[model samples]
Structure formats: structure tokens, C-alpha cells
Target: MFPLGDTHGGRIPPLNQILQTVQQNTDSLKTYISAHHEIAYRSIQQHNAQLAMFAEAAKLQSRGLEQFLVSQEKANLHIREIVGLDLKALAREKQAELGKEEMEKREPMLRNYVHALADFVEVVGGRETQSQNGELNVAASVATIKKAEVKPRVWRRG
Candidate 1:
């Protein structure tokens, strides 16, 4: 009257064999997790490196802009000096004028002054004469000339 289920042979698989199988599976899983973790870490490192590089580039751009502004200031000063000298010369010539012959001689000087003033305006103001739609604006050129007269002198030797 032995138990029917355990009648023939009550032998189970060896404990050592079961444990070996479990260890092999665990090692495989460990290898997979380690590999995944390594990949994720490398990806994060690369992303951080890219962000650092971008930040450095932005800093360089800002420095470049600062340098450009300083250069523009210097150029404005030079332009002012040249324009002042030209205007003074024109005034002196006009003051010394006697008749129509003097006026005739001064005409070319006046034209030169006008051209120089226009150039100065274009350099100082951020206005562009060329339209995006390709239409020329004659009024813009006149406005630029008037604008030059009102611009503060960058060079005033005190």
C-alpha cells in the first residue's frame, strides 16, 4: 500500500543540476543588463559633450559680437573726424567767396561734401537702400542724407 504517485521511483532531478541552470541564466541576464547600462551611459556622455561644445560656441559668438561693436565705434569716430574737416573747409571757402566765380569753384566742393555725407549715413544707420522686393526708393537716399546731418558727432576734441 505505498503511495501511488511515488510508487516506481521517488527520484527528482539533482539539486546541483538545477542550481547550475539557474546560475547560467542569471549570468546571461547580468551580461545583458551590464551591456545595456554601458550603452546608456555612453549615450548620455556623448549628449553632454555635444551640449558643452554648443555652449562654448555660443560664448565665442558673443565675444565676436562685442569685438565688432568696438570696431564699429572706432569707425564712427574716424568718419566724424573726416566729415568735420570737410565741412570746415567748405565753410571757409564759402566765407571767402566774392562773386559768381567763387560760387562756381565751390560747386564741386559742395557736391563732394554731399557724397561723403551720404556714405557716412549708410555706414552709421542700419538702413538698407536696396529693397527686398527689388524696388528702388529714391526717397530713402534723401532721408539718409538728412539723417547724417542729425547724427551726433563721435569725435569732438574738447
Candidate 2:
């Protein structure tokens, strides 16, 4: 394709608010809203699709909020110590940002979120199964996994 013009169609056409263009934009917006409503506004039932969707959104939003903290803490923050989970600094920062009155009002909801987030992270990432001491936790007789290769003797006995 020559830079001059592979085809005149590729060249920028004059911007116009034609009916077809308007209809396309409307269709796309409706689709987007429909999808969001399906994931976020559905009635809770025997299955928790809405909760799962909100949980995933929370993880993404948490990372985004991390960028806005006035002073980001380098140390890991624990949202709940009993879980022994290390969460992003923003988790602690956001909880602290709530006023004393608001915190009291939201205590139960916050507790439930902390517990759910820990369990979700553990299940999805499989991190909980690994021992905190850097060893695999299993009931098998096998002791340790030997990932490193056994090198050949430097001076072989011929």
C-alpha cells in the first residue's frame, strides 16, 4: 500500500451526524447498559452471580483507588488480621478515611467484605493452599519437591 492513498475510502471523511451513525451509537450504549445491569442489578437468588460480579469489580476498583491515595504505604495492609491476608495499602487507607460515625454504621458490612475478599482471593489464586513458610502443604508421604536438577559429578569415575 502506497502512502499517497491505498484507497480514497481510507481517507478521513467529513464528520457528520448522520442517522445511521446516531443509530449505531444508541445501539452500542443500550448494549453496554444492558450488560452492566445484568451483572450488577440482578436479583440475588440460590446462585450469587451479582455478588461474584461485584467482588471482581471490587478487586479492580481497589487497584485503581490505590493510585489516588495521598501517601501510599509501601507495607502491606491487613484488612482483617484473622485471615492473615496481606492486602493493598489502599484497603487500609480507604477504611481509615471513613469518619468515626460512618465507620460504626458500616462495621458489619465491612467485616463481611473482608472475610469474602480473603476467601475469594484464596480460592481463585490457590494461594491459601501453599504454606506461609514457603513449603507446599500436603498430606502425602512425599517430603519436599526437588525442582532443581541433580548435576552430573564434576569429575566422573570412568
Clashing pairs in 2: none
lDDT per residue (tens digit) for residues 1-158 in model 2: 22335534567433463455777889999999999888765554424876788899999898787763422221112111322433434344444666455645655544454444434444534433223222122211012111111111111111
TM-score of each: 0.52, 0.23
lDDT of 1 by residue, 5-102 (tens): 45346655466866887899999999999999999999999999999999999999999989977766665554444333443444334445434555
Candidate 2: stretches off by over 4 Å? 1-88, 127-158
RMSD of 2: 29.6
Q: Highest TM-score: give the candidate number.
A: 1
